[model samples]
Target: MKQNIHPQNHEVIFYDVNSGYKFLTHSTKTSSETMEWEDGKLYPVIKVEVSSDTHPFYTGRQKFNEKGGRVEQFKKRYNM
Candidate 1:
């Protein structure tokens, strides 16, 4: 509702470093790096450490540590 109060949004590429995945989306962020997209146009590329491509929760690769509760640990320690 204000004039020139919001940041500019433009097409940018988000690159997942872990999974080597790249996707184009709109964001207010800018980068010095640039990459050519599938549509044959160059866009500002932003590198991200985590994304849906390799995230543990999204990919269903999460690990659960079942070390047991306090009582179970006590029993195991005392051999009871």
Candidate 2:
């Protein structure tokens, strides 16, 4: 093990905006906003747009469009 060679792993909060989910983890990322946890210590808070908590795949809310409808309409108009 090398001394002072690895980046600091500090406490951080990953906030999912869509689901309003919060998770505490350690990472080397930096954030300008700070949050005081239950332990009364200030940690960096990072807001993310998407995470497993709100992702369509994990939540079983994924949306998809049917291409057959559009293709039929286009073929009828263009005679293709």
Q: Candidate 2, which segments miss by more than 4 Å at Cα?
A: 63-80
What are the runs in model 1 whose C-alpha is more than 4 Å off?
Answer: 62-80
lDDT of 2 by residue, 47-78 (tens): 98688876788889853333368789699779
Candidate 2 — worst ten consecutive residues by lDDT sum? 62-71
- Measured by lDDT, the strongest candidate is 1
The sequence of per-residue lDDT tens digits that candidate 1 reaches over residues 47-74 is: 9978888778888994333548999979
Query: In candidate 2, which residue pairs get closer than 3 Å at backbone N, Cα or C atoms, i.e. clash?
Result: none
Q: After superposition, how far is residue 18 of candidate 1 from its true place, in Å?
A: 0.9
TM-score of 2: 0.63
| lDDT at position 39, candidate 2 | 82
Model 2, residue 78: distance off in Å is 43
RMSD of each: 11.3, 10.5
Best by TM-score: 1
